[model samples]
Each structure stands twice: as C-alpha cells, then as structure tokens.
Target: MISFPFSKTPSVYLKGERLFLREPQWSDYRQWANLREKSRAFLTPWEPVWRDDELEKSSFRLRLRHYSEEARSGNAWSLFLFRRSDNVLLGGITLGNIRRGVAQSGQIGYWCGAPHAGQGYMFDALKLVIPFAFSELRLHRLEAACIPSNLRSVRLLEKAGFLLEGTLRSYLKINGLWQDHLLYSLIEGEEQRRGLSVKTTAV
Candidate 1:
C-alpha cells in the first residue's frame, strides 16, 4: 500500500505511465543502498554528510519516523521515483518545507543516478510531483533551487514548466560547501501544470 509522508491526509501513491511514485518501504533499502553506492561519486557532490549507518538498514526506522511526522503535517512528500518497466530505481524527489494556509507553497528537490541522469527521468517525475502538490496537497506554488553550475538541472526544471525566479547567493550548503543557486518556481495554474497528473509517466 502507498504511504504518505504527511499526517493529516494521505497522498502517498502517485503514478505515471512508465513510472511510479510511492512511499519508500523497508524492502527498498537494498536498492537504495546499491544505487547510492554505485553512484557515490556522482551523488556525493550534492549530498550532505553521511555517517556509515545513515544508509544502513538500522537507519530505515529513523527515516520512517521522520517521514511519519512529515506526513501528518503535510510538510513533505518523500517519494521514490522508479521505472515501472523494470522496477529499477531511478532516483528520489521531494516536496519539502511545505507551507499551507494562505501561501500553500513548497520546495522541490531531486537527484538521479549517474547512469540515468540525462534520460528525462527527472522531468517525468516532476510532472507527477506537480500534480501531487497542486491537486492532492492543494499547494499553490512549487519552488526549486539548483546550483548555478548545474546547467542540466536548470534545463530539466525549464522542461518541467518551472520559471527562473532569480538567484540566491550562498543560499544553501551542499556537500559541505556553501554555494549560490538559481531559483525557479511554478504556480498552480502555469502552462506546464495544465495537464499535470500522478498518472503521467516518464516514458
């Protein structure tokens, strides 16, 4: 069954034609660890510090606890982006720091394995995420930050219907380094979000 990261409501399951976005389960640990291990060099550049156990089986429970809090409050969506054709793990994407009420906004962040980096997977995942945020969570805006050096990510955001909002200087620290990032955002009624759906696939 699909599980949500938020507590007040359930929006745990989302799907696209060739992809499925769902809550992560303990069974997913091995795959996640393998992906991270194989893509260590590729991903470590953008990741935070990790202890040896952070990605271990023991850490799954701690992650579950954190996700439960996010689910209850509608503050986040930590979905595993996977390919339906072969059940291969593509990457992870999320809508974090969600603020409801009058703003109804949240931020988007994502990463894909090196082998799957340029295959349009992230864009496809964004399509489903946008619908999940706007339709299921009733969020009005989605924001994303990317390092200025990450031209690939910038293009993906553009293809996914996000507009460049501006730039933030040293707004975030990644891989232990503070850096400037390009900011992008998409509102609920934007052109890219017009036909957004959880059933949309990355094919």
Candidate 2:
C-alpha cells in the first residue's frame, strides 16, 4: 500500500495490486478523451446521450469543475482507474448521490473503456472500492442500478457482493430513453458475510 497527499480539494488515491484509482486530473484530458472517444460506441447504449462537444477539452474542464465541487461538498467521489504497470487509463468509477444522517448511503456507477471491458479490471476496482465505501466512508449502504439487458453489469455487482434488491421502472434516462433498471445493494456487513477480502490503501 502506498499513501500520499492528493489535492487541495477532498480526494482519494486508492492503490490495488494491478491498478490504482485517483481523482481525475487536468493533465489527464488527452488520455481521457482518447479512451472515451474509442469506447463511445460500446458505452453509449448504457450512458446518457453525449453532447456534440463531449470529447472536447472545454467540456472536460467543465466536468473536472463539477467533480471538484462534488468532492469539496462531500456529495461524491469520482475517480479514474489506471493500470499501474504502464499507467494507462482504464476506466472510471464514482460513488454519487451520497445521503447521510439516518440513510448513510450512496449510488455507485462506473464505465470501462471498450478495450478493457470483460477483462476483470473493473472487478478488482470494485473490490477496492466496496471496502472504502463501507469502512473509510462509514456508509451504511452502497447501491447500483443497471438495465436488465446489461448482463455484464449485473454479474459485476453480484460478484462484488451486491444483492438484487428490486427493480425501478423508468429509473433513469439512458441513451435518450427512459429505461427500467434492476436495483442492487450491499450493506456494511454483507461483504464480509459473502467472504470478500478487500485490501487497499487510501490517501
């Protein structure tokens, strides 16, 4: 495990065996743009409609600003996953829409570059994140929703110890249409009960 100060804004850097997760940086614009551009077709079906300037540097700057505000306010933690061996950008994961007080929950969302899909990188990333959400963040629950047709996501969540909770009709607008989504959740003690071992350093 490695640790170091990240940024002035609230942020995290998580190190795993094969990869690491860190807040998106201004210097990452080119890599981010390249990955997203190449994976656009593969990802569009599951994501919101993209803007014409979605890959432009200005739009990326705006995204970073929004991410900064979310982190500063403790509303979310957005991180980009990178392969540690060669430092290649692999994907991104976020814990968003965090609720505190009695609820103490957050929603999890992620996207992987097309080239990296179905390669187990995300599974490793999720293993690292689940523990952080439950232990470091001290959250009671973490939730995720995916369209029923997205079997890959369904399997990833289940493999990460998230149980199928129920379904939400018209839950989110994806690819320009409202779609039904299967909801899944993992409680604080559930992962351990499911025999999950996650070890990562956060700083």
Candidate 3:
C-alpha cells in the first residue's frame, strides 16, 4: 500500500503531472459557474435536473458549506479538477456515501466541462484519486454508476480498472427521469494489479 502524508486541513489536495484535485474554495465560484453554465446542455442529460438557482452565487456558497460539512465529518470528498499548467478548472469529482467498519466503501462520480471532455483530464484525475481512496482513506471498495447511454463514462471507469457488476433498474433520477444505470466497482488491490500509478502530494 502507498503511504500519504497527513493533512491538517479538512480536505486533501491531490497533485498530478497534468492536473490537480483540490476541494472547492470560495474564490472558485466564478470559474465553476461559468463552466457549468456553458456545459449545462452537455451535462444536463446525464445529471439531475438543475434547480432554478443552481448557478447562482448563493447556491454555490450553500454547496461549499455542504462540501465542507461532508469533508469534516468524513462522509465524502468533493474536489474540482484543474489543469496544472494554467490552473483552469476542468470539472469536478467526488467520493461520496462513505461507509466505515464492516463496509469500507464509497461511490465515485465525476463531471467534466464540455470544453474539456474527451481530453483525458478526467482519467488523470482518477489515477490520483483512486489510489488516495484505497491507500489514504483505507477504503476497501469504490463504486460508480452511470446511465447506460453515457458511453464515455463507461469507458473511463473500465480504463480506470472498475469492473462492470450489473445493471441497476431505475437506479437514479437523472435529468428529471428515473433511469437505469450500469454499475461498476473496484476493490483495493485491483487498481494496483492494473499497474496504475501516479505520484501524488496531499496538502
């Protein structure tokens, strides 16, 4: 198992060669909102219906508060992806619904700005975060579910070493409709066996 330095902050920051993952900050509101606004049409089909105020600054502050609470309580980790060279926001990724004790597991989810999709940024971010999930978080397994029609997501998970488990019938409400999802999972040792490695620093 890989070892990571302890962080005094509520959330850990992950740095990779091409990009980095850090918890959202108040200063990120403008970039985040702009990306989401431009990608709304691209993302809405696979995501839940957006609230009326979804892109408003007030809504963003609420989201930050919720993220902070989740991180402090160890319930989840929410991070935004940024290109290392320019520090541009690429999108967001999350490790949520964490369970401890008998079930040391969590679910993974991610999104990319429309402009950044299919450019391999999400994959790089996954290499960093997946190892952190297994090593630093001590998670036994990680799960992800996506609409069957989202071929890009399917490929991403498969490439990242998540094995397809099965189909979930009407698993989640996406874009205002309850839709079936393809379930995938990766256990702790599986990722290492795939030879996935990326040097990461947590701060």
Candidate 4:
C-alpha cells in the first residue's frame, strides 16, 4: 500500500501512465540505499558528496522528518519516483524552494537510478510533476539548475519545455566543489506549448 506521511494534505499522490509519485516511507531505506550506492559514481559529479552515514536508516529518518514539515507547510514536496507496474523505486524528484503570493514559483530537481538512466523515466516523472506544480500547488513557474557539463540533464529539461534562462556562476557545491550551472525555467502552460503530453492526475 502507498503510505503518505502527510496524509492530511489533499494532494498526496500524483499518478501517471507508467510511474507514480508517492511519499517515501521508512521501509524504503534498503532499496534507496542500494540504488544510491550502485549509482554513486554515476551520480556524485552532479550531486553533493555523500556523508559517511548517508545511507543509514537514522539519516533517512531525519530527511523524511525535515521534508514532511516542508510539505505540510507548503514550502516543498520531495517525492520518490516509483514504477507502478511493479512498484520499484527508481529515484527521486523534489519541487523545492516554493514561493507563493506575488511570486508563484518553485524549483525542481531529480535523479534516476543508474540502471534506469536514459530510459525516459525521468521524462515521464517530470510530465506528472509539472502539472501538479502548476495546478495543485498553484505555481506559475518552475526552475531548474544543472551543471553545464551534465548534458543529459540539460537535454531532459529542454525536452520538457524548460527554457535556458542563463548561467549561474559557482551556483552550487557538487561533489565537494563549487560548480557553475545553467539555469532553466518553465512557465505555466509552457509544456503544452512545447507539444509534450501532460497527462496526470493528482489526488
């Protein structure tokens, strides 16, 4: 069964054709750890250096607690990607840094397991999440930043209708070093303009 820690929230699950976005559970620690470990080398260059206890159950519990607060407060939603066919945990996607009122926008970040890379799963996940960001979350814009050298990420964002906004010099620390990133943004209804099907249901 799908479990949402933030069960009181009206928007807890987002469903798509092949994958579903759901809240992460403490029981997912083993699968999450194994996938991250196998994808460490493939993921490190684009992500922060893993802490010594990065895969520990205690660390994951802390992470879940922090994000649970973020979700309930309408500040962010950090969801794990899972294949609906067999309920396999593929990776994660986060719509963070949410701003409301005058500036209705949020930034998105995502990753896929090494074995699942290049399989268009992230693309499908983005299709599901973007609509939720715009409709359920009532955000007007979504932003993403990626290392310039990470061509796959750049392509994924562009293919999903995000426009290249510009470059952010020394934008974020990745794998222990400051790295520049190319900024991308997608406005409300931009995906439709780009001709990508946005078929999803949020409940």
TM-score of each: 0.88, 0.95, 0.95, 0.93
Better of 1 and 2 by lDDT: 2
Q: Which stretches of model 1 miss by more than 4 angstroms?
A: 1-11, 192-203
Tell me how candidate 2 scores on lDDT. Answer: 0.92
RMSD of 2: 1.9
The lDDT values for all models are: 0.80, 0.92, 0.92, 0.88
Of candidates 3 and 2, the better by TM-score: 2
lDDT of 3 by residue, 1-203 (tens): 22233643476789988998998999999999999999999999999999999999999999999998888788999999999999999999999999999999999999999999999999999999998898888999999999999999999999999999999999999999999999999999998889985658854
Worst 10 residues of 4 by lDDT: 1-10
Error of 1 at 197 (Å): 5.9
Ranking by TM-score: 2, 3, 4, 1
Q: Which ten residues in a row have the lowest lDDT in candidate 2?
A: 1-10
Residue range 1-203, candidate 2, lDDT tens digits: 22334655776888899999998999999999999999999999999999999999999999999998998887998999999999999999999999999999999999999999999999999988888888888999999999999999999999988999899999999999999999999999889888885878854
The Cα RMSD in angstroms, rounded to one decimal, for candidate 4 relative to the true structure is 2.4
- The positional error of residue 52 in candidate 1, measured at the CA in angstroms, is 3.4
lDDT: the better of candidates 2 and 4: 2
